[model samples]
Target: MRKLILFDLDGTLVDIFDEHINSFIRMEKEVFGVDIAPEDMIKNIGHPARVVIAGPLLERGIDPKVIEKRMETAYQSYKKQLGKALKRIGEDVVLPGVFRLLEVLSQRGEILGLITGNISTVGMLILERTGLVKYFKVHSFGDVAAKRSQMIERAVELAEEKYGFTIKKEDVFIVGDSIPDIRGGKEFGCKTIAVATGLTKGSDLEKEKPDFLFSSLENTEEVLKAFGDQI
Candidate 1:
């Protein structure tokens, strides 16, 4: 049996909450001429960015093609701005205990993978900048499709194909910071571990019925104690 752990990047691994919110606001205003409220935008934080943009465009009767073009332009602007912002903020720091936990897991021969809503480019940039890129052996990006479940499904498939091992639904864990992460993981019958490091609070995540919940990556010891033996 192979034990695989899939992590969500933005909130679970790196703290980019405010940077993302502001970046989206800037892009939305530049391309759509509409200022999105942070609260409203926060609601869609953990899903694919393209799907998030397209949903509202459809509601407003905009053609998907046009919306896609505008989104590309907006994303370009966001990339430039985000690059500058990252320099000022320095490389993102890992949440407490993350390094230690990942080190232990890697040494134990557990498969570590990434399934994030961020596009491949942006996700890679963040991981490279944070020096955490080495931890992930497989990744599924949001740019592949807007649906979260679809992204995870692809990641799982890639894992199976690349590693030459079968992964049971229960043997896979999706660790992330929002309800969508929990929902998507469950949709595929994988275990869900919710963390309260992003927009959603622990209490709110609890109501969503994830298999597990934690305040932050600092709970690494607890996580290992809970799941390490299974691996």
Candidate 2:
């Protein structure tokens, strides 16, 4: 069966952990004059950029209302800095087997969509740079959605509208490398595939009990099987 496979960009498809953390640190410290720790950022990975940013600020005793007020401005600066960061990092961030997996999946006629915590521009930049943008027909972004659940909803809505076909929830697969991704997929009534290629520990991902779990997507054939590919 052709599945509606929704992918999380940052950790699942690419290892942007370093650039992401550094950019967040610069945004919070330089723009907000507040030091944000890398660990705090890691704890909140896979969340919307706002939430990922807010967690550390909130922990630093910054008032929630204040953070909310500056978020629009802060995120704007963040996107710019992150763009520069990615440009510097180049396409090396694309993870192992990502191209081959996406290639085979696209060739197989399965629908692919991006459901990421990254804002549209930033997310598209990464995809464009890595040449993976062509494979995805649907784009669900973080700045547009307050939560992963909302992103998932947008992906489904856009997919159906773009392709003119109703997508069953069970046929939708949420692929990511964090707890929120798995939890949100389950809550949204979709199959979840957990990959430990992100900052999340494999044991923690196991606790969430995704429909399928893999250490990484390096084994193209094996990972394909999880997506129900006969090969």
Best by lDDT: 2
lDDT of predicted model 1: 0.80
Candidate 1 pairs with clashing backbones: none
Question: What local distance difference test score does each model get?
Answer: 0.80, 0.88
Error of 1 at 74 (Å): 3.1
Encode model 2's per-residue lDDT on 1-231: one tens digit a residue: 458999999889988788888888899986679987688778888898889888888888988998898988888888888888877765578899998899888988999999998878888888988778899999999899888888899999999998888999988999999999999899899999999998889999999999999999999999888877756
Model 2 scores a C-alpha lDDT of 0.88
Tens digits of per-residue lDDT for model 1, 1-231: 668899998888888778777877777777877767777677678889786555555665777788877877866776766676666553436676677778888888888999888778778888888878889999999888677788888988999999988888878888988888999988888888888987788999999899888888775568875564622
Relative to the true structure, candidate 1 reaches a TM of 0.90
Give the clash count for model 1: 0
